[model samples]
Target chain A: MSAVAALSYLVASVLFMSGLKMLSSPKTARKGNISASLGMLIAIVVTLTDEKILDYTFILAGLLTGSAVGVWFALRVQMTAMPQLVGVLNGFGGGASALVAFAEYIRISGDASLSVWTGDAPLDVLITLVLSILIGTVTIVGSMIASAKLHGVMRSAPILYPFQKQTNAAILVAAIVLGVLFVFDPSRWYLLVIIAGLAAILGVTSVIPIGGADMPVVISLMNSYSGLAGAMTGFVLSNNVLIISGTLVGTSGIILTNIMCKAMNRSLANVLFAGVGAEYDPSVQAVEQRTVIRYTPEDAATILESAQSVIIVPGYGLAVAQAQHALQELVNILTAKGMLVRYAIHPVAGRMPGHMNVLLAEANAPYDILMEMDQINDDFQNTDVALVIGANDVVNPAARYKKDSPLYGMPILNVDHARTVMVCKRSLNPGFAGEDNELFYNEKTMMVFGDAKETVTKLVQLMKS
Target chain B: MTEGLMISIYIFVLAAFVGVEVISKVPPLLHTPLMSGSNAISGITLVGSLIAAGEGHGGLSVILGFIAVVLATVNVVGGFLVTDRMLKMFKKEPQKKDQRA
Candidate 1:
């Protein structure tokens, strides 16, 4: 039975790896998902077949309940709310691992007199169980808070109060002390409850001070926490397969998180210890802004026709308007007119990392045409025109020069450096962080105010004419 | 087989089945977030590894467990930090408004 289980796990792991690899590219991602799901199905069937359980009722009930809820969430949750839902699911995974460890510990404790059980139950098992519970509880609560913030049920800005940091420190100390006590007295079940409560509080407090803008990172962090808990539980059970899979997930998540952090030009310590994304008024004076160039669709088309090089920068507005395909069409037309067409993708342009890339890839935009911020920012200066569709903070020059701006020191698309710039947006409202964008009023920039898709569509038509 | 082993197998089966179904419905837009978020959940594996290390009475298991715990911790902490950093970019208002005019 163990042999069969091992084989099944091996197959599942292979499928998981392949699925993850396929996920890197959009074209094959769906097929990759299906393949992975099939592998999981096999794993499930094989594991169930090897089980000696006769009481299927409770197991079936659990399966049904979980599936029902999972299906409902998968279907009903909006794409915007998916991050929070993912957080909730991550918490559940941690909680489940913790519960499994607890149950195993309880069983071992119940049969202490049995030498066979005593032989199998090592001190390592007890340690793993406790650690899994503690970390699992923390992941659950922390992830829940992250979900709430993403869903807009809680504040997006860092929820900092006077002495909030001090209180968090105190809670950490208390939880650590409690964890030590639990390790010493495994028989005292109440210690487990206490540790769990303290850990949950720790998780919540850790994430509470993190601002909404930092949610993706927080969510990633929580994901790493849950993965570690799973691996620890696997260690307790001596489950090699679980350890391998858990480690893979844990490492990959960390790497991806690091990539994201680099894109934002922030240190990990600053993100974790400092109250990042806290709302503060900018000290920079609002320049008496003047639009030097306001172009109708026809005028923008005329400029595009004469341009030698054009760089298109996309933002969340593109996603909201579902304008990737339309933008792709526009890109094609410009390319045919002997203009050099490329996309300038800021690392943090949309709601998450690679957001603009994903949107563009979905539209079958050539990968070669999509340029990173660093790669294309310098070219913007030499380019004839920089066209921004629904992007804001990423194009703002304030990040480079204005220390008082909320986006100070952050990397931007350098669209302002272009010879000519065209911006398409619906309104003058501030972005997610509520900081004013300075690029909209630049001398070389042209404001083409409308819905991104509609405006791009009109521009495409004018260009065709 | 022992009832515990049987139950464990059953749990694994159920979890796998459910996990596949849930992941299938996830849209492309939510993929990165879900992946990052789920990675955090998976970091719970570290807690188990940490416990294993503390409980190990002798040399080999303890050493292995400790290494696993450290790696897992790195994964968790680094991953979260990176993720939060990435999210900071989205928090800023597009400064393009000034350039537009």
Candidate 2:
């Protein structure tokens, strides 16, 4: 590589690092993204110059088509669909890495003069190549399934059959064995295709058993796999910029995954394998029979009018009903009436980490008022009204002491400590965790049944009158 | 071990540490954007795709490279653009007072 090209890559790597560092605060996040994109632009242009292309037709066509589609998707996607969009994009990145590795293999193996085994440690290159293909293929297929599940194309419930884990384990082991065999005898290249096939199956089987509520972890893990695949391809191509940038993304995903798992108070293995939210248990019928006072939105508004303080808890149901704007309107009205109003965000409240925040931000809610669980958990006790909007399991007090429940160990918001709890939900059904919420049955709790958007809008209207 | 592989390993290890350090500082408020933004960075695989496509390899290699390039570009462009869109919505507070000064 020329000195100029090497120096440019180094600069690009630095830009990526600085950009990520700047993301720590919202004030600089937009600028950080723009700078990182500039870095990408520099890397692409420098790479084009270095490769000495004989034909620009394919490159031009690919670039133009990709840009148009990418722009359309980015511009057209609703805030509620962000997780699905990210999942699809992650899949593309992984698929690209796998394809690049395959192309490299074809380029080298086809030319008798340039042997793949010519390097000092041929095994190193071969291993990297196999790893790239395996990881990349797995990431792409797994991401597609995950996105589909999130998009409602597949059932949100965990899909399980007998001996599922054992099957996934066997497929993985077989793929590894084949990968080693192919490394020894590169002649039987068909092994690569079989490995990719196994990877695709592994992707499906692995993601199918994870329920919708656990998508935050799955999405983050898939993001990590996509980056690791990129790094493996970097090793195959011996590209420093790719290695550095890919590793950065890989670690970022790993960190997010860890944080999500911690917030849910579950181990990574339990999240992946326990299939925690698989079925709505029959035991919930007992809780359903327990009597609870059902309140109207008018009543809720009256209750709110007298409250000195309010903390709103949002969950996935908010996104499903497209009620963020309505909820925000209610918040505005409450604030205008001289009541202290704030939003309490549970980490795993919605479909993904930061899901509720994104939806609320889209509704133009001020970032200052959106509080994390730890920041506001203690204040719930002093708050006059804890308005639960389209939320469930997160506020369930049973998690504090119910050992047999799936949510037993999971950290929940301290909404039960509030003076009065009002819940707006579609029905009395349990949440994705399938655990009946004890908070819903508490004496202080008031259940308001209806579409979240309609109920919140009614509350706003009533308060205005 | 080859000197090139050794250097790449060192770079990889150091970059991993840098990744953890920088990412840990990102608060949960920006976690969604962080996921999408770093996803764009992962599209660096486009570099390899470009090389594969531009080099006059074979029909199959060129085709594979072309598809790879397109996918990587989508990952790059979509990931960054969507992240920017989401981040744009995250305001510290509504613009009520002019503080241009």
Candidate 3:
């Protein structure tokens, strides 16, 4: 039976691999997801039928209740709330790992007759158990804080004070000490609980110092931690399927974290600790009084009509204004008029990686016209009009040269290079990075002040007329 | 470490490399789905959760294992369903037959 179970797990792991491989392309992504779910189902069924099963009531109830809640969340979530949803699911994954490790500890410790550490061929199960609990507890707490920030339940600003770094270090040190003590003496199981407590505190301290703009990096890192926690649990239980899948998730998270960090031209450490956008720099003067031409929808429409090529750049404000559908309508009208139109997506354009793409896809925009930053950036120079809707920092030219600016050294859309730049924004305020956009004041730029949805809708209506 | 532990370590190292290689090629367009999908795979801890819960140690272990099973199930089920929902949104270009000429 164990052999059969092992073979089934091998099959399940293969399914997960192929599922992930298929996810690399849009045409097969949905099928890939389905394939992975089938793998999960197979693993679950085989595990249940294995000889370890002494009863089934608790397992049945848990499966039913969890499925109901999971379906509820998956069905009702808005596309705009995707980051929070993912964060919550990550928390659950980590919480499960911690709980499973804790249960294993209680099981072994309750039966005093069996000594786990005495054999010359030690499994190091105790050490893995401690690590699983530690990493998993941290992931749960960190993911909750991140989700709260994304959902606007908590202040999105970085919560910092004197000695914050030192305080976090102390908590981590305390957790490690407790973990070591538990590993050495299995009788000291209470120490494991304390270690989890310290780990939970460390989770809060580490995540609270990151501001909302850096959430993509924080979430990716937490996702990695969740996977590491699972891997740790796999070692505790001697489970290969868990280890392989967990390592895969851990690697994916690291890759994404690296990509997001590179896009902002910031290292992972700076994103995690520097708290870059904590507050507006007081030294930067209030340049709000600087004047710029504010164009109406009608004038913007006229300029857009004559443009040979246009690149649409979107940001979080597009989600806030719920203007993706309106913008897509406008794109259809423009495309029909024999004008070349495409979207320019900065890697960090929104709160999460690929956030703008999800919103645009939800609005029914075809995938071919959506262009990543590296792909569409150069085309902006030859383009007649660069229409920036609800985006600021990504299009700011200061990133290229303003050394004193927080956004400096970061890659930005070359919107300023277009023959004409049309910006539709609610106001002339600086963006989330607290850096003023000089592109708004450029002679070639025209600022259309209004809600993004209203402005884009008017443009669509005008184009239709 | 036991031979089993050593083998597990080897598998972990090799799988990590495979993950980086396989995931690196995923286009930015499908990143959200990629994230959610991999998240579901991490829920493989559900296997451990089942063993623990079904063992029915008749005490705190059962309670903890039950909760673990529920949470792991939510991670697996919710992650895949949400990934599918998001991927379903990514429609390909409408057939460009009108411009073929």
Candidate 4:
């Protein structure tokens, strides 16, 4: 039975690898998902029916109830809320890992005659058990907070209070002490509760102060922690497949986090730069404020008609107003008119990483036309019109020069450099960074203030006529 | 270390290397799905949850086990469903293969 289990696991792991590999490209992505799901199904069936099972009722009941909820969430959620959904679901994964590890230890403790139960846990089991509980609890708490922020239930800004840093420090010290105690005396079952409580609190407090602008990194980092938790749980269970797949996810998630951080040009030493924007710099005032120029959609159509090329810079507003279809239609009209149209996508463009791609793809926009920030940044200068759609901070020139601004030193698309800039936004409000964008005041930039979908729909109609 | 621990460690190191290598070139366009899909992979604890739920060692263990099972199932089922939904959203550029859900 063990040998068969190992074989089944090996087959599932291979499928998992291939499924993930296929996801790297858009064309094979759907098939990739099907492959991975099949792998999971096989693993579930094999494991549940194995000789270890004493009762099937709990597994089936849990499976039915959980699937009903999962399927409902998957089908009903708006694409704009995908990040929030992912955040909460990842929390569930972590919670499961922690609970399983805790329960396994409890079961072992129930019997004192067994050597493994009577004596201290071997070093490997002890370390992995602690790690699983700590990281898993953190993932659950941190992700719930993150989901709230993304869901707009909580303010997206960092929820900082006085003495936040010091209190967080105290919690860490307490949790670590409890962990050490658990290591020495395995039967102090109550200690698990205290340690878990501290760790969960640590997760919440740690993520609360990370501003909304940092959510992409936070989400990826949290994803990595969940994976790490799973890996640790694997050690507790001696399950090879869990170890393999969990490590894969853990490593990939961290790499994704690094990619996002680099895109924002952030480092571990970002605190030093936090004060860089505290003092109002003279350069911020240097921009000569011009009376805002608001253009009608008809006027935007006229400008776009004469342009040889156009680049659409999408932001969170695009998702908020569900404007991807209208934007795509406008693009089609321009494309038919022999104007070159491409989507200039920032890595962190929407609420989550790769948000714009999913939005545009849902609109049936061709995948080849969507260009990454690095790929399309240089082309903005040569483009006839850089159409800004509801994006604010990412296109702000302040990132390049206003060293004291929160958005300072971040990489932005050079949309301001384009020959003609058309900004389709709802208002003159500052973006996620909550600072005025100097780009709006530029001579070449014109604000067409309205709902993004409404404005884009108007543009599509005007251009078609 | 015992041979059991040694084998596990060996598997851990090699799998980490392979995992790193496997995810090397994921395009930026797939980051959301990548996050979602990895969340599902971490749901491998569903097996552990099953054992705990069936072990029925005590009342407290049974309750915790049931919840763990549900959570793991959600991670597995929900993650894949959402990921597939997102992946299916992409309208391919004149693909030779039929691209229907």
Native contacts kept, each candidate:
0.07, 0.85, 0.81, 0.74
- Candidate 1 lDDT over residue span A386-421, tens digit each: 999988877777778888766788888888888999
Considering the true interface contacts (CA pairs under 8 Å between chains A and B), give the fraction that model 3 also has: 0.81
Model 3 misplaced stretches (Cα beyond 4 Å): A110-123, A281-289, B94-101
Give DockQ per model, in order: 0.06, 0.68, 0.63, 0.62
A65: Cα error in model 1, Å: 3.0
Give one clash count per candidate, in the order shown.
Answer: 69, 0, 0, 2
- Across residues A2-90, which tens digit of lDDT does each residue of candidate 3 receive? 89999999999999999999988898888889999999999999998978789899999999988998899999999999999888888
- The digit string of per-residue lDDT tens for model 4 on A156-275 reads 766667787778789988887888888888877677778889889998888787776678877888888888898899998888888888888888888887877777777733521232
Highest DockQ model number: 2
- Compose the digit string of candidate 2's lDDT tens values, residues A1-465: 788988999999999999999999999999999999999999999989974577878888888888888899899998889999899999999999999988887765765333343323367778988999999999999999999999999997899899988999999999999999989877666888899999999999999999998999999999999999999999988889999998999998899899999988899998888887876776756646778788998888888999999999998899899998878888888888899999999998776678788899988799999999999999999999999988888888778899988788888999989999999998888877787777887999999999999998888889889
Tens-digit per-residue lDDT, B1-101, candidate 3: 57989999999999999999999989998888888889989999999898888896656788888999999989998999999889988987733323432
Interface RMSD of each: 13.0, 1.5, 1.6, 2.0
Q: What digit string (tens of lDDT, one per residue) describes model 4 on residues B1-101?
A: 88877887887888888777777667898888888887887888887898888864576677788999999999999999999998887765623323562
Lowest summed lDDT across 10 adjacent residues in model 1 chain A is found at: A111-120
Error of 2 at A442 (Å): 1.2
TM-score of each: 0.74, 0.96, 0.96, 0.93
* A444 Cα displacement, candidate 4 (Å): 1.8
lDDT of each: 0.64, 0.89, 0.88, 0.83
Query: Which candidate, 3 or 4, has the higher DockQ?
Result: 3
